[model samples]
Target: MFKNGVFYYYTVLSILFCLLSCNSDSSKPFEDFFNTTVSTEKELGYAVEIEKIALDHIESSSYIGEIGYLKDNIAFVDYRFCWVFLFDYEGNLIDKKIGHGKGPNELFIGRISGFSFLSNGQSLFHEASNRVFVFDNNWKKIKETRINWKGSQKYGKARNIKRPSAKEPIIYSPDFGNLKFKNFNKKCYFPIYSEHSNFNGLMGGYKYYKEGRILAELDLSNYSDINILRLLGRRTPELLNYSYLPHHSTFNFDIDSKGFFYIAHEIDSLIYVYDHDFNIKYAFGVEGENMDTNYKELKKHDVKKFRELFFNDRPKRGYYSDIKVFESNDQNLLVFRSYRKSISSAYDGLQIYKNKKLIVDTEVPKGFEVKYYKNGFYYSNGTIEEEEEKISFYKLKLYHSVF
Candidate 1:
């Protein structure tokens, strides 16, 4: 009898121990579980080299916006010209079709935001019109849906009153007056307007008008917004007010692995991490030169520095062109693109940041583009003065793995 009693007691103790471990404090700060190591092989300035292949015409122009690879060795490319091009793994163009209706000037290439590939060999795409379109493996249009929004009038008037500054390139909408309403592909787009007011005099605020918006779908849906936010920063109410009169606001959101939704604003350069229940986990990045200061303050003191440190130093506009998130070995890798006319002939390059710190600066030759792939990196250089357009793929070599 004593032996049986002891066994029961031990079992109870084990159960209690497990219960205690499972009850983690919900307020704990997010902990990063991955480490990043740089390559040590002489730091080649341009590590990627392109191999020329016969160019086959898929679309009228080769200005590809988004690209995705499927399980069956099929690749999808989104041409900003309102078309989706499907290719094989070997970069051979297989099929192409227009994304919009047939009209000489009716299809605006700028309206298409992103394209996504599903496990079922279908593709999903979003447009500025606030609509999401689904296509099959053969690039055939399947169905289209529009996101619903309430209180759009109030949001619209708020946007037009404040617009984005001229110096800053508008990431989302170029025209504030004709803002689209809907949440296609889980995307929310809001318009910014310029307004003259006391609280945000000469400055603008981004009204929370829309949600469930998709900008790009290279990786899992959960990683999209977080990837872009890490590249840009945050949009402030004051800054939104400066966008344009009766401006609108759009939110592109995706839930991360830990049930946190990563949100990014089109006009602002900030990224916000929120729990599944809509509670904010943390916010990263700031506008202009003050980003460094805000980052340092946030690190030194676990206090929220959203308003004081970042908003105060917001620039009139300018800086940063694109942001993307890439994952390798279960770690989130951020890539930021900055355009500087004063730099080399091709003044675009990828700034690699891990854990909110700038680590390596990989330059993309002039007229070329850089994107992160599953194994390594993909780059495409458009033909310039005497060079022909070319694309290349490379794998990243880590110092730890080599030594």
Candidate 2:
């Protein structure tokens, strides 16, 4: 009887210990369990026919800030010169307008920050003036309405705003900053604050997915690993763990039409796709490539300096320039950008992935930023430099058969 009682008491104690351990370690880690490293020795074998179109003739002093698709035959280009241009499918300059003044028709050009295309033929231009300008298909200024979003004292500014419909706007908070809604009957939303860092902003990859699953980037440079926040509508956010592979530098993220999340590295050539549960769905990339290999590993502090470190040449490191996704016919078009150690401002080349598999790595001409649309890719070289003045833009079409 005595021996049996002793055995039962130990079993109860063991159960209680396990419960405590599990509660203490609530967050999940994604290092060895989720690492998807690609080889740096494979060569790219896809053909992309490039064509250049000159938009500089329209406005010599203007440069392309953002490019987007309006319809099957229409494209909208934002010119930091205080105007937006409309182009046809063939890249012909169709119509344009200027909204750079404080008049009724004109807008505070400095306040015009971003734009979003709606299902209707109108586009919404978000401005720092706390208003949005609605432009019709003919480039006519239809109306300008005020928005409810104001910069949060905690979060620096709203990263982006998406209006799914006319009802309410979905505001994306910055990774390192705070986002607070003014008119809404809600408390302050999310704030990025920690003891180590004074100011916080998102590293990148801020997406609002289906059913209120917001994937936010967390800057964990102080710690070894970065964090991913899975936030619901009003409930507390669940923190997920992520680690950087040795060769991988920046981890940018994107989501497809099917709700699959893609985690792309700036230095490493490989791209990883994760399901809703954050499991590695698929991994693909090329070998002997990716700008990461060209760089020499610098001190860990170099990561904090990012651009400054490269410019000073104290410890040069490769930087991930850009990452975006285009969804079509149930397949995902992934774009990744990488830059050399010396020239961090311009992208070295772009690696295009179709459905998570590498299709091509196109080395764009200098001073061009390549953007993907439903039909094809647009490379704009209008933003900088005297030498870049020659070429305005380039349209590229990829032939998958050559891959």
Candidate 3:
């Protein structure tokens, strides 16, 4: 009896010990969880490197589609004239041809949203009709397939309405290709915006197309809604003015090579990292500002004043526009672009981040837009000289150790 009693006692003690160890929070320090370092020096400052690429007669209009680089040093760019032009690395136009034509059921001078070089040495261009046109190396159309637009009804209902009209079929922008992935399926994710909402917002949905038919549809409405709020609040100050809520949110929505999802939502400005199965793994970020106590309590007449205080309370400087993960030196580095105010103007400088740390800051040349590229960042001055009507491209050199 004593032997059995002792064994039971030991078993109970073992279970209790296990529970204590499992519930222990002593090892995980609060500082390790939350990054509280506010360094001005580590903050990004802009530097410019100017190199001119010759273009004889590039159009003045802003182009939407991507510029693809082939293995043979060929650059393919979309022109507003319903054509894709092939150019050499030296900015000399090599060949240009019609990508699409106006027909009974064909695209009519539609804008190209994305251009990609497929693994088979072919090119894929996503057009306005939710279709991807495949082309050979010589800019010849090989095949065309419509991209599936998944969750149209759910996306429509979110806006308190049915599907969009034929004339206004919730057209998608090329930014969908901006979602980073090593290998892209013959699929496209579209962002649908609710016209009825008081706030300008949208949801992300995807359609998978194989052969000539849509094979599958994925509804990302729930996940997209969660992300939309965070995206809206972070980028646009005007939206934050309406909500006037103290806490802001951040979501890191990423797709892996296998098309699985990775989402990290920042609740009350506190980050929560989740994998495709919605399992929480890690989190980091600052807590939301105390709106009630921090801002002066004033009645309805002070609405504008209230908004100013609310947006001002948060760290206005460090907001990121987008984040992408890429393989570098066998380690996955998360690259993100951020904007900072220039001493002269607002939103003038560009900052790059890797692994949640600032790495590079490319300065804008008086007036220019900086875009993130795979190898480096591209800067373009939006001005078009009437006589020249040519666009300029500047490449920024990155220091790798910053990641």
Candidate whose TM-score is highest:
2
Give the least accurate 10-residue stretch of model 1, judged by summed lDDT: 224-233
Candidate of highest lDDT = 2
How do the predictions measure up, each by TM-score? Answer: 0.47, 0.55, 0.50
Lowest-scoring 10 consecutive residues by lDDT in candidate 2? 180-189
Off by over 4 Å in 2: 1-45, 60-64, 72-81, 109-111, 118-253, 275-280, 287-307, 310-317, 324-347, 367-369, 373-391, 400-403
lDDT of 3 by residue, 1-403 (tens): 9999999999999999887654432222223322333322233442445455544454433443444455544343543545555565556766665544654323354676655565456665655565666666666666665544433344445355443321222322223423221223443232232233322222112110000110112222222221111101012122233333322222334444645432333222333333333233454333212212232322333445645644564334333333344446656454333332322344344444444445455544433433334345443322334355564455555544423
lDDT of 1 by residue, 1-403 (tens): 9999999999999999777544322222222101112222222232333343233345354455544455533343444567555555466777666555554322343557655565456656656664556666666665555433322234345445444222121223312222322122333223332222312211223222111122221222442221111111123332333333122133334443344544545344455555544345565544322222211122222123423433443222223434444445668545333322223233444444455444445444333333334434343322322133333332333222222
| Alpha carbon deviation, residue 48, candidate 1 (Å) | 7.2
The TM-score obtained by model 3 is 0.50
Ranking by lDDT: 2, 3, 1
| Candidate 3 Cα misplacement greater than 4 A, ranges | 1-52, 56-66, 72-76, 100-108, 113-122, 127-132, 136-138, 145-147, 150-186, 196-241, 244-325, 330-347, 366-387, 400-403
Worst 10 residues of 3 by lDDT: 206-215
Model 2, position 158, has a per-residue lDDT of 27
Candidate 1, residue 239: the lDDT equals: 31
Candidate 2 lDDT score relative to the true structure: 0.44
